[model samples]
Target: MAEISQVSLGDAIYDRVCQDLVEGKLRPNEKVTIRGLAERLGTSSTPVRDAVQRLLRDEALIQRSMRDVRVPVLTEAQYLEIASIRRELEGFAAGRAAEMVGPKEVRRLKKIVERNEAAAVAGRWPQAVKYNQEFHFALVEAAEMPILLAILSGLWLRMGPLIAGYYAREQLGLVRHHQAIIAACENRDPAAAAAEMRADIDDAKEGIIRYIQSFTIDE
Candidate 1:
């Protein structure tokens, strides 16, 4: 077996926990016990606690008590609100990236988008989730705007559970959305890029809202 490389314990624990949450292994509204989580991750309670605290702050996990946490359920309204903000922010980032993107960054973004599309087609939900995130973050990083990146980072965390739901349900054509956005980037058209970004996010928001509404009506 290959040895696991050592890294920052808190970050390591957080990434693992977040992956589980996004991949539906750690389900929404399910309780998370720090000691149990730590044991499962093959780490100590300290790092797990830190990771839980961060997740709580991110609203990915809600603090139910002093030592207890649960994955927060996504509401329809909250999903729409988060998606709206994310679209605006991501559109701004995309426009900025279009204006400032160099050949190297454009190539990088293309690769990320291509990988995301492949994952979506292959039904590799986790890889799709990872690559979609990488594509957006790569665009923001290309702009060299730390403040914008920070804002988008907060929004992404809030959207994580909802995005996980989208992947699991598999309702929309994510690959097509990504392909359009990549085409805009390739053309170096800021307005076109922003428009594509907004469309992609809006489509996702609609799909999630419709899904949630069906459940609500059923209830």
Candidate 2:
């Protein structure tokens, strides 16, 4: 019974840390310690250690020493590689979502964009970043493509920290492409939806490259 409980606790801890990565709660290159995370989460070190191990394996976290673990910062090449892949996969998901999206889903997406815009304007960058992720994930989920969503989630786990760094450094104007995507979904135009999704992903390229360069300079 104790062993089973520990296993469950480990899984729970793993998912909580994953949310931190996926939601950009952690920043790129920020150092992490099991003791700190355990305290922050009000848990023991055992489960936190287990969860951090999984993130390390996922390449979401990099270990610099026996005790030093930090979020991995992507290079310009790495970021672009992932972004290119995202354009294809997420664009396909958006196209499929356009095919299946109903009025309710369209409204939900619009609401998400609205919230994201508001957060951006208010300079609540973390909130904006979270809503941005929510909007993309919502679009993919609407497609009802479980396998695609799983693949995208892995990509996002790597991107979230890097993206958060960008957002913290700049203002957001990416919503125009998102709005275009919403319009394409409203029109039930799969090609337009896919194109707009690709555009949105493309828009990130410049900002992410700039951010990556800054990281390189800092390091």
Candidate 3:
């Protein structure tokens, strides 16, 4: 029982840290220390260390020296590589979701889109980013492909910091490709839904790639 409790605590720590990464609260290349994290989380160091080890094994956090760990700063090439995979997998998920979507799911997704648009209009970048993540994950979840969703979650963990930076710099367009996706889903057109999903990812990739290139050139 105690062993199970400890494992649960470690998992809790891991999840909290991952949520920070997903929400862009953790920046790229930011240093992380087990003691510091434990302090911040108001817990003991054991669970924090366990969680950090898990992240290190997942390549979400890289160990530097004996006590140093940091988030990876992905290069432009790396980012594009991941984005390419996302285009394929995420598009497939959207296609599957099109077949599975019901009126309730459609309305749920529409609400998410509306919330995202409202956040963007209010110039609330963080809220926009949160809603955007919610929207994508919701679509993938509707597909009911657990393995695919797990893969996409890992991809998002790596991309979240970069995405936050991107939305911070650019204005959120009101008529995003999400509308097209919603329409396709409403019409029960799988191919069109997939195409729109791919297009949406490609559009974001282009902008993010440009941003990465400029940063690299500056460096």
Compared with the true structure, all predictions reach lDDT values of 0.74, 0.90, 0.85
- The candidate 1 region of ten consecutive residues with least summed lDDT is 210-219
Tens-place lDDT digits, model 1, residues 56-167: 8878888767865777667877877778888888898888777887789878877887787777778877677777777777888987889988787666666665676666
TM-score per candidate: 0.81, 0.96, 0.90
User: What is the Cα-based TM-score of model 3?
Assistant: 0.90
Q: Lowest-lDDT window of 10 residues in candidate 3?
A: 210-219
**Per-residue lDDT of model 3, residues 52-118, tens digit only:** 9999898888887897788877898889899999999999999999999999999999999999888
Top-TM-score structure, candidate number: 2
C-alpha positional error of residue 31 in candidate 1 after TM-score superposition, expressed in Å: 3.9
- Candidate 1 segments whose C-alpha is farther than 4 A from its true place: 1-8, 11-27, 65-68, 213-219
Pick by lDDT: 1 or 2, better one: 2
Candidate 2 lDDT, 109-194, residue by residue in tens: 99999999998888898999899899999999999999998999999999988887787788766488889899999899999999
Candidate achieving the largest lDDT = 2
Q: After superposing candidate 2 on the true structure, give the runs of residues whose Cα lies further than 4 Å from its correct spot.
A: 216-219
- Candidate 1, residue 212: the lDDT equals 60
The residue-level lDDT of candidate 3 at 34 comes to 90
Enumerate clash totals for all models, in the order shown: 0, 0, 0
